[model samples]
Target: MLARTLGALLCAGLLVGAAQARDYRYSDAHLHYVDFFQETEGMPALLEAMDKAGIEQSMISGIPVAKKWHEDEPKRPRYYAGDDADAYWYSATDSYVAAAVEKLPPEQRKRFHPFLSGINPVDKNAVAHIERMLELHPGLWQGIGEVFTRHDDLTALTSGDTPRANNEAMTRIYHLAAERDLPVLLHSNITSKRERNPLYLAEIEEPLRNHPHTRFIWAHAGSSMEIHRHQEKMDFLLPTLTRLLEDYPNLYVDLSWSVLQPYLLDDKGTPRKAWLALVERFPERFMLGSDVVGRFSSLGEQFQGFAPFLDALPEDIAHKVARDNFLAVLPKPR
Candidate 1:
């Protein structure tokens, strides 16, 4: 009789657990990471921050084109036939030869397991970066993203307007993500085109047509600028934000900076209708993000920046937005 009673209680507990995972995971699907040379260091410290904020894991992303490295491709230096064998391998020869070339100045590349980039030609060694990260700490990375597309640089690369370069880079990253079977997080902006960016319409709708299963997420919903600065544009993004939920099944939005979305309304002395619309229209598409990069003031800092947004969320809907929904898109844990 005692054994039967304990077994019954255990079953009850398991049922409730499933309910929690389904309804209240509270995962932050978007985040940025900075290495030693960036604003700050200490990569492993994020584990504690996530634990305290009730955030489970975040999608970590790096810069594809970095300021530390050359934004433009390097011109190959003419080599003389009689030059010494050692000078022939100078890593400084160009951005393509990168750190691998023996005798050359080291660039801003972080030596994570000794990753040096000045000699690593991004185009040729694009696959190598992914390989290095995987090999260095086999399963440490959760997702691949925060990769950005610059309109100016890409236009110069492609020769045509926005579509040419942006599409090519998007296709490149999309193919790589699909090859590795990881969902990508894009810093989708409305400023791609020269005259009329159409901020949301052209960028989001067009890309999905080519790569159907690419698992591309749009950070900030349809937000164009940063929360602190673009306090005005939240109202502008409303119509497009609504359209995203209806059209893009794979697309998701984060509420990381969106507490400011409501605050924006209050500042303008406008009705709170748009805020309610966001909560009601796409509860599943939202997730929390702190957007902290370096050694922030508080420990488990997700709670610090994320508290306002989380508090504004409806209780049951908050549970889904904060956690359970993101697990649907996150890369499977190794």
Candidate 2:
């Protein structure tokens, strides 16, 4: 009878401990304040959602490019790339993000770390535009990108311009980012959605090798929504990530919602042993993100989705991935 009572108490304690783990607050390393389709609920709503979701901090940026409408389509796309022909650089989006952040109370504003996303990655004048924006904002912008290069489907649609991670234009931007002490969150998909091979790996590798000083947060760990929808699993993801993390000290992985399934969690929604081991090995190098575009209603849900993965991590490492890692990477205040 005494043993049974003791076992019950132990079970209760374990449950309480699990609950505490799930309550871990997060610093969302990747999220968009605005998107091409103008689907956002705006700043006030986002703050409310962040508060509700226990997101203490976030890296906010506007989509640097806009998806063009395809007139031939029988039905308009709810999303930018649904049936859109191409994506084009639109600098005004950055102003919208800046304006929203500026309106927040100083306390609330501090939670938002804004990144400059207005410059076209392939444009010859990309560096000039970045300099101009930095001068204009005067410490308002904290980092650069969500810069799209080698994006699935979108890359093919990117009319006339072919943006590459190692392009001269991007190299110039990397140099400037190093000088300014800003991290660059680049979205260079490692491969096309249909192809399992890391075809575009060179595009990102060159930049990592060339600009060792510039911190590069590889968005979705080089995965995309299309990849998630089409492929049950990326056989190459774990090995590729292991190599990149081992190779590039400056490279960080953004394990956003897109790569959650098959990569981080198995079919049963439990954390994969390999992924947990990877995080354990390089806790500081991995960060979580909702990758929510202009929507606050789902913010809490998006954050909660990582609870299982977080619970499985060592306490200190979980805390770092949830919050500290991102804060550690942010540019020091001027």
Clashing pairs in 2: 40-294
Model 1 stretches with alpha carbons more than 4 Å out? 1-26, 63-140, 150-165, 192-197, 222-231, 262-265, 268-271, 298-312, 332-334
Question: How do the predictions measure up, each by TM-score?
Answer: 0.60, 0.93
lDDT of candidate 2 over 1-334, digit per residue (tens): 9999999999999999877754688999998987676456888889889999999999999887777677777776766668756667888888888899998899999999999888888887988988998998898988998888888777777766788999999999999999999999999988877777888889999999999999999999998878777775778878988998999999998989988887888889999999999999998998988888887788889878888898899989999998999888889877
- Clash counts for all predictions: 14, 1
In terms of TM-score, how similar is model 2 to the real structure?
Answer: 0.93
Clashes of 1: 14
lDDT value, residue 270 of candidate 1: 50
Can you tell me which runs of candidate 2 are displaced by over 4 Å? Answer: 1-22, 70-76
Worst 10 residues of 2 by lDDT: 76-85
| Candidate number of the best TM-score | 2
